[model samples]
Target: MKNVVITGTSRGIGLELVKLFAEEDFNILALSRNAEPVSSIELDNVSAFSFDLGTEVDLKKASDFVENEWNGKVDILIHNAGAFLNKPFQETALEEFRRIYEVNVFGLIGLTQQLMPFMDSSSHIVSISSMGGVQGSMKFAGLSAYSSSKAAIITLTELLAEEYKESGPVFNVLALGAVQTEMLAEAFPGLEAPLSAAEMASYIKNFSLTGSKFYNGKLLQVSNSTP
Candidate 1:
């Protein structure tokens, strides 16, 4: 069976990804801050791990779980954990900016590094980015930290792809448009998103499993341009 590790599986796109992949019979290592949502599902192929991206202890525990249980061989790794800070540049405090980076950037790198031993040449690493970070898009006022962090994800993915070009695992990032999720709701109140979390999850599933066969280090943007 193919082994898949996904972060931020408590809800939103992460939750949906777990459900979708479960249907395809993949062994799922679901990581979330709260394990209740995933544990309630009660699937034999799915295991829930409670963790916080900003917590070093939690990250170490998660890596330990993967190393021991998964035999250090993962087929796919999805980085979906993120923090949002919707404050104007001047209003955004240094601590808040650091918090965002801790989860979106540092923690992501730390976790990925820990899990590298469990990945083979056929493994794929996918990070969910945002359109806010993509160039040529109109910048919003209150997303300085969040957008910049996502932009960092894109660059990081590209660099990893280059560094691992002759190696085995593939790296890619999806610069998603507004998806109707709690994160989007919190970031942009009352604005309806053109895409749903389930929809995005489906796209991510297909891409994670097959897109690597054709593309690597590509920042594929998905949006309806309704904003």
Candidate 2:
């Protein structure tokens, strides 16, 4: 079986991803603040680590611990821990931008950097992005903060994918369309996602485990009904 690591496993897509992967019998190193309550992760195949991604210290420590914690094995790494804030470009606070990018950008990079020491050849790193990253849809009005942050994620993923091309591991960003999750409702209240979180998780596990053939480092949209 494969060993996987996922961030933001407390709820939403992260939680769903953990659930699906666990059901598939993959050993998971799940990270989040409140993961103890998750029954799915209580099994022998799953282990939870509680830590806030905003701090660089936590990233370093968690990565080190997970390396030893998982017996130095990880086949897939998923950077799914993220936050969302919707507001006009003007009203968006610089601190808000910092906070959003802290978890979405710097923090994710920090954690990945530390985790790489443990990952062997032929592993995959999947960063969960958004459709907002690719297009300036009508959704761009109040999503300046959220969209811009995800855009940064895509750019980062691309840059890292290139750096890790010949060596290191496979790095790809999944520009997932709106899925039933708290982050979506925060951006657009009362709007339902075309896909459920479980469906999204199913697709992610399948796509992430594909052959190491290097696809162009770009954002990918996840469609559950068909992938």
Best by lDDT: 1
Off by over 4 Å in 2: 39-41, 135-138, 214-216, 223-227
Among these predicted structures, which one has the highest TM-score?
1
Candidate-wise lDDT, in order: 0.90, 0.79
Over the stretch 1-227, how does candidate 2's per-residue lDDT look in tens digits? 88888898888878888888888788887888787755554788888867788777778767777667777667888898888887888988899989888888887888888888777568888898877776653355777777788888888888987887777687888887778888877877887778888888878778778834556365787644211
- Clashing pairs for model 2 are none
lDDT computed for candidate 1: 0.90
lDDT comparing candidate 2 with the true structure: 0.79
Listed per candidate, the RMSD to the true structure in angstroms reads: 1.1, 2.7
* TM-score of each model, in listed order: 0.97, 0.91
